[model samples]
Target: MSSDLVRFDATRLAGMIRAREVSPVEVVRAHLDRIEAVDSRINAIVTVAADALGAARAAEAAVLAGEDVGPLHGVPFTAKDSIDTAGVMTQRGSPIFRGRVPEADATSVARLKAAGAILLAKTNLPEFSYSTETDNLLTGRANNPWDLGRTPGGSSGGESAAIAAGMSPLGLGTDLAISVRGPAANTGIVGLKATHGRVPMTGIWPRVPRRFWHVGPMARSVRDVALAYSLLAGPDGEDGFSTAGLGVDAGVGREPSRPLRVGWLVEPGFGPIDPEVAATVQAAAEALRGVGCLVEPVRIPALERDDALEIFWRLHVMEVKPAFAEVTRGREGEMFAISRAMLAEPDTSVADFVRAEQAAERLRDGFADYFGGHDALLCPVLPIPAHAHGLSEFVINGRAVPATHSLSATVPLNVTGLPGLSIRFGTSRDGLPIGVQIVSGWWAESTVLHLASLLEATSPVRDLRPAI
Candidate 1:
C-alpha cells in the first residue's frame, strides 16, 4: 500500500484517509520518501517544506481525535515556486529572489491549508515563469517523468513532473499562454485553466497583464482537479480580476443531462501538426462521440488567423514586459534568455497595441459565437509531443515552427478569458503522452469540466502512469 499510495489521485487518497485506511503522517512520509528517491533525477521539487512532517503529525492527531475533517484533509500537495507559501521560499525561479519568503500563503494556498491539505513542497518553473520549459538558474531544469531526456512543458513543468512521478497528488500552477495546460499535456496529467478570474492570482509573482494570467490546479485526475478547483476558485477580495466567480463548484458529478455539443479540432488554424498528435486528438473526439456527445470537427476563423500569435506577442510586449521593466532595469542579464530577449525587443507602437487589443476582442467574440452552438471545443494541446530538454523549436509533421508556436492553441482562450482544460487521452508511438484541450465560453468552467470528465472516463491513458 505504501509503494502504490503515491500513484493514487488526491480524491482517492482523501477517501482512504477519511476511511482510516491510512494515516496522514504515513501518506506524507510515503510521498516525501518518493520525492527523495526520484526528484534528484527529475529536479521537480525546489524546496521541501521544512514543517511538512509536523503538519502531517497534526493532521494524524486530528483524525485520531475524530474531529471534523475538510474535504482534502491530510492530502499532501505541492505549489509552483511562484505561488506564495508563508515562511517557505517563493523564489519565482530566479537568483534575484533567492532566500525570499512570504509572510502569508497565497490566497489559494491559504484556502488549501484551511481545507486541511498539507503542503509538501514547492515545485520548480522557468525563471519568472515566463518560458515554456521549466528551467531556472536557481533550481535548475525539471525533467519529464515519461522520458528523462525530454522536457516537462513549462512554466508549470515541475508541478506536472512531480505529479506524474507521484511525488505529489495535486499542485497549483499558473497559466498565461500554455503554462498549466501545456505542461499537463506534456506530462500526461490533468491541468485546468479555469475562466481567467475563477481562481484568484493574489500573491503570485510577476502579477502583470492581469487579464491573461491565471492560477489553477494540476493533478493526476480530473476529479482531483475538480476537487482542488472547488477550494481554489472564487474571488478573494484582493485581486480585482478575480471577482467574476465568487463561489463555484469544482463541477465533479454535475454531468450534463442532455447530449453535449462538443466541437473538436486537430488543425485549429494553427499551422503544422504532427499526424500522430492529430490522430490522438481525433481519437478523443471519437471517445466523446462514444459517450453520447455530438462531437464534430470545426474551425474558428479568428484562431486560424496567422496573426493570432503576433497579436498575443504584441500584447505581451506592450503590457507584461513594461510592467516589469522597472524592477528588471539593471538586472536584464540575470533573467532567462527568452525574458531578456523579449525585453530587448523594440516597444510596440500605440497603433499596433490597439490592433492587438482589437484582435483579442475578435477572438473573444469569435468564441462567443462558436460556443453559442457548442457546449465545448476540443483541440490538440500542442502541435507535437514533449521535445528534447532545451530545443528552442520543434519540427512538427514537416514544418519547422518557432518554439513559441506552442502557445497558439492556448492563447486564443487566454485572449478571450474563457476556461480551458487539458487531459491526457492518448500516447505517441514513442510512448509519450498526448492530451486534448477543452475550451468553453467565459465563466463556463462547469461546461468545460463536464466534457473533460466525459473524456476522462474512457481515455486509454486514464490509468497510465509514467515509468519514472
Candidate 2:
C-alpha cells in the first residue's frame, strides 16, 4: 500500500484524498516510509519535518469532518533547504548557517501550506545553493536515484532526487542558471523555472542577485508543476519582482485555439550538445509537429552573438559575491569549496560588466524577436546526461568544454526572464534521463505549461521510473 501510495503524483494523491479513497495520514506515512527506505542511499533529505505526521492527522480529521480544502489538500511536499520553513531547519547546505531555522515560512512554502499540503521534509543542495552539483559540508552529497554514482544536478539536486525516487511527490526548487531545470532533466522529472519573479523569492537565500534567481515547482508530472505554479504565482508585497497580479492562467489541460507554433534548436548558440541530447530535442520538436503544431528548426541570433553563460557569470558573480561575503564574514573557516571558488572569482570589471549588461539585453531582445513568430522555443536542457559527482569539466561532441558550459542552454532563459520547463522525453544510451526544454515569452507560463502537458500526454518515456 505504501509503494502504491508513493507512486502517485501530487494531483493523483490530492484527488484520492479528496475522494476519501486514501486518508491524509496514509499518504503522508507512505512518503515518510519511502524516505526512510530510500533516502540513506540518495541523501536527498536533509531534515524531515518533525510535525509532518501531526499535520497529516489534522488534515485527515478535516477531510473526515467534511470541511473545505485547498487544491493540494492533504498532499505532502518537500522544499530545498535553501527555502525557509517556519520551524524546520533550513541549513542552506553550509556549516556557516548550521542549526539555523527560519521563524516564518517563505512565501512559496507558506502558500503550499495554505493549499493544505503538509511539509514533508527539507531537501539538500550545494553550499549556499551556488554550485551546479548538490554537495555541501552540512549534508554531504545527494546522489541520483537512477545511478547512485551520478548526480541529480544542483543546486536543486536534492529536490529532484527526492521526487524521482518517490520520496516526495512535489517540491519547490530555485533556479539561477540551471538549478531547477537542469536537475529535473538529470532525474527524469518535470521542473518549471517560471518567468523570473512570477513566484516570490522572499524567503530564499542570497537576495542580492535577485534578478536572476527564480523559485518554482519540481514534480513527477507536468500537471503537478502547473497546479503548484498556479497556486504559487502573484504578488507577495515583499518581493519587488513578484508584482504580477493574481489570476494568471496555468493552462495545463487547455489547448490553443489555433495550432501553436514552436521552434527547436540544438547548437551553435547553446555550445556543444551531445548527439543523444540533441536527438532528444529534435524528437520533441517532431512530436509537437506530429501533434499538428507548426514546428521548425530555428535559431536566435543573440544567443550566438553574446554567450549567455558568460553574460550570466559576469553579471551574477558581481552581485552574488558580496552577499556570500556578508554571510560568511566571520566564519570563513566553515565555508565550502564552491563558496570559496565563488569568492575567488575576480570581480567583474566595469567595462566587462557594462558589456555583459548590454549583451543580456540583446539576448532578451533576440528572444522577443523569435517569439514574435513562435509561441514556444524548444531546446536541450543540458549538453550531456548526469555526469559523475564532482566533475568540473566535460567533453561534448569530441570537444572539451568547461563545467560551466553545461549552463549554456539554460542561462539564456534566465537572462531574458523567460519561463522554461524541463520534461523528460528521451533516455540516453547510458540509460540516463535526457530532457527537452520548452520556453515561452515573459508572462507566458500558460503557453509553456500548456505545451508541456501536451508533450506529457504523448511522451514515449512517460512510464519510465528509476530502478532504485
List of clashing residue pairs for candidate 2: none
**Looking at candidate 1, what is the lDDT of residue 206?**
68
- lDDT per residue, candidate 2, 1-468, as tens digits? 778999999999999999999999999999999999999999999999999999999999999999999999999999999999998999999988899989999999999999999999999999988889999988999999999999999999999999999999999999999999999999999999988889999999886669999999999998899899989999999999888854554332366788988999998888699999999999999899988899999988888898888899899999999999998998888899879989999999999999999988888888889888888999999999999988878998789899988899998888889999999999998899999999988888888988898889889899999988
Provide the TM-score for each candidate, comma-separated: 0.97, 0.98
| Deviating ranges (above 4 Å) for candidate 2 | 246-253
Q: Among all windows of ten consecutive residues in candidate 1, which has the lowest summed lDDT?
A: 246-255
Best by lDDT: 2
Q: Which lDDT value does model 1 have at 219?
A: 96
- Deviation in angstroms for 189 in model 1? 0.1
lDDT of all predictions: 0.87, 0.92
RMSD in order of candidates: 1.7, 1.3
Candidate 1, residue 93: the lDDT equals 91
